[model samples]
Target chain A: MLAKRIIPCLDVDKGRVVKGKKFQDIQDIADPVELALRYNHEGADELVFYDITASHEERKTFLDIVEKVAATINIPFTVGGGIRSVEDIYQALQSGADKVSINSAAITNPTLIETAASKFGSQCIVLSIDAKEINTGKWNVFQNGGRIDTGLDAIEWALEGERLGAGELVINSIDVDGVKKGYNLQLTKTIANAVYIPIVASGGAGIMEDFYQVLHSDIADAALAASVFHYNTISIPALKNYLVEKSVPVRSVPSCQLY
Target chain B: MIAIVDYGAGNIKSLQIALTTLSIESTLTRDETVIRDSNAIILPGVGAFQDAMHQLRSDNLDKILQEQAAAGKPILGICLGMQLFYETSNEGGLSTGLGLIKGKIERINANVKVPHMGWNTLQIRRNKHITTNIPDQTYVYFVHSYYATDIDNDDLIATSQHGENIPALVQHNNIIGMQFHPEKSGDVGMQLIKNFWEMVS
Candidate 1:
């Protein structure tokens, strides 16, 4: 049985970990590697480091942070943000990352996904969609940290991503980003059902039950969170124990700190 | 020193990190001289069968690997690298393999998840070099859409329970192939690597 994954996303900027209310007014958390080791100890299936930067210098720092986190965590970790070319994906993978995620780069140059997939295989490439509900309930894809709208339909983009060899799809609900109401079930299902690749549900995980509800459905193979984990609201071991109680099949937690 | 063949397929850092943690001295290389002189070889890949074959052929490293295996130099194939060891693969389209083992690669049934992306326990069928001390039902990480099939030989040392019996480990003397990434599979995975290193040493 495939284990259900619990991932905590850390937004990296200038080598510091930050989480924002809907990705705005960011608040500094701990160092990226520090928080990563904590979760890795707590039995986190994986970690995602989103490099949210607006400057080239800061982006370089994000790579440094990624290298540090990759060194710190024993589990699989993914890095995304400001990646625009095949060389960027290669550098990230070579820097010790197991996966390299892309958003705006894929939307701007769909060929980048093809090139990266061809070079590094689809398993290393992840397509993250920042989806926001527009008027009348149609979902729109957002870029530049959810500030600029690409006007591309979320479902259509996901389908194309799969066609272009995206190994996984990360459906992040913009409306539910930090709202913690719950996952956007409908949107997640739409993309998960459309693409044959694995789908990871991102955004809107407030409690253990939220994870239960979202995973019970066929929407996502994994769920990602940041604040809940950073604040230590729900420790990973306890959460996995709860899921085990609920009969949610998961990987056996490492009995001790692997490091 | 061990040599990890880098033909531009997947991440080699995890394996390098694992090797370093174990105090195992190894080099990530594609140069034929370095690989041929190494004590053992670790061939890792992550990609479509055709693309991997293309890369291996283009780099002319395929011949060196075959020669090493022929010389009875222990070679380990991790995940996609293992798939390439088979005779043929039907992933995406039918493609030729390295013919190191008598098997074929096929896609996991669509009814089950397209990519078997997580941990599952190993069920040892026949105890061998890789499964010498690995307890039955010990879980290891896996991530792939295709699986090795059409193997009628008893070289299938272990199996992992899925919707069906998926081949977990298959070994033939010095040449061993692992369907899972032991390097990324934590301690158990490291144990497998350490055991291999001991064999070649």
Candidate 2:
């Protein structure tokens, strides 16, 4: 059985993590590379580092951060935010990211996904969606960090992502941004049910039960949260242990779970 | 000194950093003499099998690894390197492997996730000396689509569940292979590497 993964996503801008409050006003958090190391030590299954605007700004800082993150941490890290081309993906992979995620670029140039998948293998690419609910009970797609609405249905766009060579899909709920109320389980489940690829549920994780809620749900393959993990409100090892004891099917280092 | 065969595959530095953490001196090299003289050999790799195999073949390190494994001095392969220890690979129109293990590498069934990428807990089915009776279920990190499948049950030391029965650890006497990245697996990973280092000591 594949263990359900709990990921911590750090949205980095200019090397500092910024959590978009309501997917708008961004606030400084911490140095991304240091945070990455902390999460790696804390037993995070995997990490997502979105260099929020690497594509637009052409910030070379991501590479430096990635190289250091790769050197300092041992866990698998995925680099995203402004990855528009195969060459960009290759550069990130060379910088030590286990995977590269694409957003706006893939929407603009769907062939970039095919080219990247063919060159680096589909497993290296992750299709991320910043989703917001719209009228008529349908969710709309947002790019450039939810600032631009593409008027695309979330589910259809997700299927296109998988079709265009995305190995995984990250359905990040813009509505649940920093709420800590719980995850947008229904939205996550919707995407997970739609795609054959592994789906990582992101946004609105407030408690340990939220983690379980996502993992036990039929639609989610993984759950990702930020503030809770960064603040140590609940430790990943503890959460994993609790889930393991509950027989919810989670992966945890042996000693931590047993004790 | 231990020799880490780095043929521009994966992050070879992780292993070097791991060795440093273990206080075990090592050098990253493709030099035959450096590899031949080292007390132990480690083959670390990632990326596509065909491209990685091409680099190894071009460097002529495949023959060296084959000879070294045959000599029965501890030789460990991680991830793609572990797949290379098999008889042949289904990757890219079939390529010959180092034949260190009597098995072939095949693609994982597409029904399950294509790349079984994530953290998976290890079930130590066989109580072997290398594992040192570490608890039955230990979590380790993994990131690969293909695994040594339909393998002989005897060769399997540990396993991870992911729809397909993934071999967490495999050993044929002194030649050992781990499907996960022990270097990046944190404490559990470091302990496994520490155990491997102990084998040479």
Candidate 3:
């Protein structure tokens, strides 16, 4: 059986890890590479680098950082944000990223999904959707960092992504993002039941119990958290141990061993 | 020196980085002479079987790899490269593979997810030198939709349970195949690579 993945997302802006209200406050928590190394040693199943910076020069630095991180860590790494074309995807993969996540760009050009998946096997393309609940039992898809509402139904959009050849779907809940309440289980389960591809539930992971709830509920293949992990509020090794106690089948390093 | 046979696979950079971290010198090349003269050859790939085979044949790497294998050179195939060692694959059509091992590649049909991505424990089938250092049931990363099936049981060395018993490791004399990416599988994977390195040395 494949173990449930625990991912630490690094939201990078202007070559720095940023968070807080409106994502304006640039927190000097730690260097992205150093934080990545810590997660690698601490047993993070994967690392996600979301380049919030849109400038071409910053993108180059992001790819350079990607090369450094890939050279240092021995786990799967995913690069996303500002990836609009197949060329960007190729650049990221060539820079040592194991997978590339497509968001707003995927909506502007649905053909990008097919082009990328066909060019580089579906295993390398991840379709990340930012969804916000508008009415009872309804959610709308958002793009451009959740600033534009596309009016596409979340479930329908997920199916479309699968049809377009996305290997996996990262359904991020804009309603619950940065709130640290819990994952939007209803939205995640709806999409998971709709698509056969693996679904990674992102946003609103406050405690280990939040991870246990979503993973144990069978609504998500993986749980992604940023602030909790970045701010040192939760430790990955400890969280894995907690999940093990709950019988959640998460990979863990031995007590005294980490390489 | 180890020559990582490059056929435009996605993992070339990370694979080379993994070897460097282990202090093992290696080169990514398509030159027939380099691959033919290396201490060991690694066929690394990540793509559709037909496309990868097409690339290999177009570049004449298929002939070179077969020649090296015939000469008793240790050859290790990773992921899609592993699938290429079989007789045929059912991906994107019934494409033929390099007939180095007697097997057929088929889609994983055990009612589980198609890709079977993430970490899983290895079920060691044979007590081989390549399985040394790494303890039984240690978790390793995997990412693929198709798997090797109908292989000679004698060639099978290890299996990992994902929807079904997917072949994790196989060895037939000088040829070896690993379904998972040892480069991205962290410490346990590094140990497996080190074991393969020892075999060639």
Candidate 4:
């Protein structure tokens, strides 16, 4: 049986991890590589490094961080945020990222998804959608960090992304992001049912039960969280044990000494 | 030294990085001489079967790899590289492979997801050198839409379930293949790499 994945997302700016707080054991929590290694050791199925750096010059530093993380960890990781073109995707993958996630650029230029998927297999092209519930049971895709509404139906956009050759979809619910309540199960389940590719549920993961509810219910193939993991609100091993107790199959946290 | 056969199929930077982390020297080269001189060869690929086979044949790597296998030089094929070891693949049309293993590649006709992309436990079928020190039901990462079917039972070393009995690992004498990307499979993957290195050494 394929095990459910637990992912830790890190926001990187100018090569340093952002929002990384409350890690006394880690000498430098700001170091993306160090944090990534910490996650890998704790049995994170994959890692996501969102390059939130805005300056073009600082983007080079983000790529450097990608290289360092790639060299340090063996688990698959995705580099997302600010990926605008096929050239950007190529640069990220060339710098050792297994996959690159595209958000706003994908909405503005949907063909970018097709071109990138054709150039660098669909398996490496991840379509990340930022969605918010605008009306009863209706969600709209948002851009620019949920500031602008694109008016694209969340489910429709997910279907289009799959049709456009996106191998996976990361559906992030803006309403539930950082809410600590739970994942927008209705929204994620709707999109997951609409698409054939794997759907990664993002934004709302407050407790280990939130993960169990989303994953065990089969609403999402993987659950990605940032603040909870970054702040030590939820430790990965303990979470996996909880999931296992709930009969949710998860990869056992392997001893890192083998490597 | 290991020569990673490069035919422009997929990004092999992670594979090189993994080898470096294992303190093993490797080079990504299409040059026949470099491949011939290396202690072992790691065939890493990601893409459709026909396109990859096309690139290999165009660069004369098909014949070179055949010669290496004939000479008993250990060869490890990862993902699509492993698929190329079969006799035929139906992806992108019915195309021939290296024919080192007796099987044909076909789309996974299972109820689950098409691309079985995640960590799955291995069911070691037979004891082999590659399975050394590896625990039974060990988890490894896999990402693919097709799988090898009708393979000889003797060559099957391990299997993983994903709506069907997916061949996770196979070996026939000096030729070995893994349907998953060991480089991205975390510690168990690195252990497999180390074991392969030990076999070659």
- The best candidate by DockQ is 4
The DockQ of predicted model 4 stands at: 0.77
Q: Residues A1-259, candidate 1, lDDT per residue (tens digit)?
A: 6777888998887788888885678899898888888887677887898887737778677777777776665678888887888878888887888888998888889999988877777787899999998975589999766788999999999999988988888999988988888888889988877778888999899999989877865778899988999998888888888888898876666585333
Estimate the TM-score of every prediction.
Answer: 0.92, 0.90, 0.98, 0.97
Clashing pairs in 2: none
Give the per-residue lDDT of model 2 (tens digit) for A173-206.
8888688888887888788877778898888899
Write candidate 4's Cα lDDT for B1-201 as tens digits.
Answer: 999999996779889988988999999999999999999999998888888988999999999999999999999999999999999999978999999889999999877876788899999999888988788999999988899999999999999999889999999999999999999988888889998988897
True contacts kept of 4: 0.73
lDDT of model number 4: 0.90
Which lDDT tens digits does candidate 1 get at residues B52-124? Answer: 8888899898788888889999999989999998899998789898888889999887577666776778888
* lDDT for residue B11 in candidate 1, whole number 0-100: 76
Q: Docking category for candidate 1?
A: medium
Higher-scoring candidate on TM-score, 1 or 2: 1
lDDT of 4 by residue, A81-123 (tens): 8899898999999999999999999999999999998888888
Better of 3 and 4 by DockQ: 4
Model 1 chain A: ten consecutive residues of lowest lDDT: A250-259
Tell me chain A's TM-score in each of the predictions: 0.95, 0.91, 0.97, 0.95
CAPRI level of candidate 3:
medium
What's the i-RMS of each model? Answer: 2.7, 3.7, 1.7, 1.1
Q: Candidate 1 or 2, higher DockQ?
A: 1
- Every candidate's lDDT: 0.83, 0.83, 0.90, 0.90
